[model samples]
Target: MKLKKRIFTILALIAVAIGVGSVCNTPNTAQAKGVPTVFPKNMRGTWYQYYTDGVEKDLSKVKITKTTYILGEYTPKVIHKYIPHDKPDFERADWIFIPGYQKQRGITWLNVKQWNEPAGIGIPDTGDDGEDGGWGENGGEFFNVSKLKGHQVLSIANTIDGTSIHNTSHWYRSVKLAKKLNKRHYKGFLY
Candidate 1:
């Protein structure tokens, strides 16, 4: 009995050691703590995006500035799941994100949208009528235009390739190759 007890203890110790020995370190994603007042300098220019771009669709014609990320007249919905509109109602929408950046588990690619793209900002409606009329999509309809996947999160890499801002996404890519590229490392995309 004493021998069996000793063997069990030894096995438990070995299991614990092995469990603590292997740790998977993946490269990543991050969101902002507070609302960023303005855009950064690194991503402050017009970039002709390819299919490999992040969430926003300036339709290859993406313009970035200190305060806004302006999209072109034609933005398709396939690349960005939360666009919410069949067709752009106006020429350009200078949107901003109020919910901050997002990248949860069970999925790859860090993306943000209004009141959740499956999930996003949970800002409850004060009393403005939109699609769901609450913290749902179009939460910014008659309220604020910047809280959706307008891709302000997408334009982020262009803003600070380093750490110019706090809220950020790792989905940014190179439009030149029309292939795919990442300026920021993605640690959140765990497959």
Candidate 2:
């Protein structure tokens, strides 16, 4: 009698698990690969550019609400300057990465689509120098931000290059150490 009851309980648990999976209507092995429309809390900050020489430049006074891109939404007419050729189809972007990107290159992938709930449910302070926690912009007039490094910002945009044929990228960071690092390099030259 005891053995029969244990077998029935185990089977019942398995059935419930399968039932829940079906109700969710998502494959058990499903993984989200798209970025969320909302900007993550970690990317907020006034990032100062870190040049190839590792020098921190003047802080950007530009006020921008952090956000992500939904490539299919905007048309060429809207974001014409940002696009390279202004082609009709802009749904897919082309870039190739080596297989096993994280394992081989140690690249951290920020993978998600939409917040589990909407933004502002539970918030934390990132101290982005008055760029307080809020929803990102609907339509941006200028540049588009690509990658971030916690307190730092990394961007590869046509707007930054400005009429140059070649595209360029840069890295910026919010180093809270001092106003300007390497002060000894130049007495009156720094900051």
**What is the TM-score of each predicted model, taking all chains together?**
0.30, 0.29
User: For residues 1-191, could you state the per-residue lDDT of candidate 2 as single tens digits?
Assistant: 99999999999999999999897986354245332333345544444432334454543322223443323233212111122222323243221111111111122323221121113222333686553232222111122234432324433222111122112233344444223431212111112
Off by over 4 Å in 1: 1-33, 52-59, 73-97, 103-175, 179-191
Give the per-residue lDDT of model 1 (tens digit) for 45-150: 6554444346743325555566555555543212222344443333323233433333234221222233232223333335554333223332221111121223
The Cα local distance difference test for each model comes to 0.37, 0.31
What TM-score does model 2 achieve against the real structure? 0.29
Which 10 consecutive positions of candidate 2 have the poorest summed lDDT?
95-104
